[model samples]
Target: MTKTKIAATSDVSADKVLKSSANGQSVLVAKVGDQYCAIANKCPHLGLPLAKGKYENGVITCPFHGSKFELCSGKNVEWVESFAGIPLPGAAKKLMAMGKTPTDVASFTVTQEGEDLFIEA
Candidate 1:
């Protein structure tokens, strides 16, 4: 495992996901209270960047397909909730899920030394 220093503690504020890289892998780091969590930046559904998604209470929702994921555990809370918050019709949602399946996002370990945060990639 390669430990890469991504950002300072101050750079990642409470409830804000900071986009960074670890050994050429795109990563998103966030501070949930005193714990730091790192996860893949791309949404597994369609590879949409989770950095552009909405985050709340450790849950990040993909902006494109409305897939929600838990940052700390990299679990998929919901797959394809809606399209840009516009409730997708039943048939439409079913059609959209034709080729996609629910999958967990990749999570990484985070280490902190002084004010710097590092991610293991």
Candidate 2:
């Protein structure tokens, strides 16, 4: 499929993120300086909305279970460390993983077209 418009560059400022979806793909556009990174808005660990999570230094931290992903490559940086910024114990964190496994978030190629941003869906 062709790349689709996600959001206007003006809508996403430096160090901020914007959520968009097209062709049934939910993506999060993060602008850091002159570069942009697009990643799936759903956390791979729990299928939660990554748009509601916190992102900083190219790392998007899931609000649930503290799963963190690197936005640029959609790589799993950390998994199930804590919830909402609180640290978790080894046993509890392991139990939370009973039926779930850690996985990296999905990422899409992004480019700027004029004042708008496009993502490959």
Candidate 3:
């Protein structure tokens, strides 16, 4: 495993997700409550960056397809429920998903020592 320095403690907040990289792998780190969590910046559904996605209560919603993921655990909460900020009906949502199944985003180990945060990639 490679330990990579991603950000300072002050660089992340509960309301924000910081986009960084570890060993050339794009990563998104967020401060949830008192812990720092790291996950792949790319959304599994469409391979889009999650930096601009909406984050709240440890969940990050994809800005493109409205897929919601648990930031800390990388769990897929909801998949392809909407398009471009507009809600989709059941049939439309499934159609828009294009037969893609729910997949969890990759999570990394985040170590915070004092003011520096490192990710294991």
Best by TM-score: 3
Residue-wise C-alpha lDDT for candidate 2, range 10-82, written one tens digit per residue:
7886675788897888888887556888898998877889877777888888888888898778999888988
Q: Pick the candidate with the highest lDDT.
A: 3
Q: Write one digit per residue (lDDT tens) for candidate 1, span 1-121.
A: 8879988998997777999998888899888877899899989988879998888998898988888888888999988878887878778887776678899999987889999999777
lDDT (CA) for every model shown? 0.87, 0.82, 0.90
Ranking by TM-score: 3, 1, 2
Model 3 TM-score is: 0.95
Q: Rank the candidates by lDDT, best first.
A: 3, 1, 2
Q: In model 1, where do residues sit more than 4 Å from their true spots?
A: none
Tell me which of candidates 1 and 2 scores higher on lDDT: 1
TM-score of each: 0.92, 0.89, 0.95
Scored by lDDT, model 3 comes in at 0.90
Over all chains combined, what TM-score does candidate 1 have? 0.92
lDDT (Cα, tens digit) per residue for candidate 3, span 1-121: 8889999998898987888898889888898888899899999987998879898899999999999988889999999988988999999999988888999999987888889999878
In candidate 1, position 30 carries an lDDT of 88
- Rate residue 11 of model 1 by lDDT: 94
Clashing pairs in 3: none
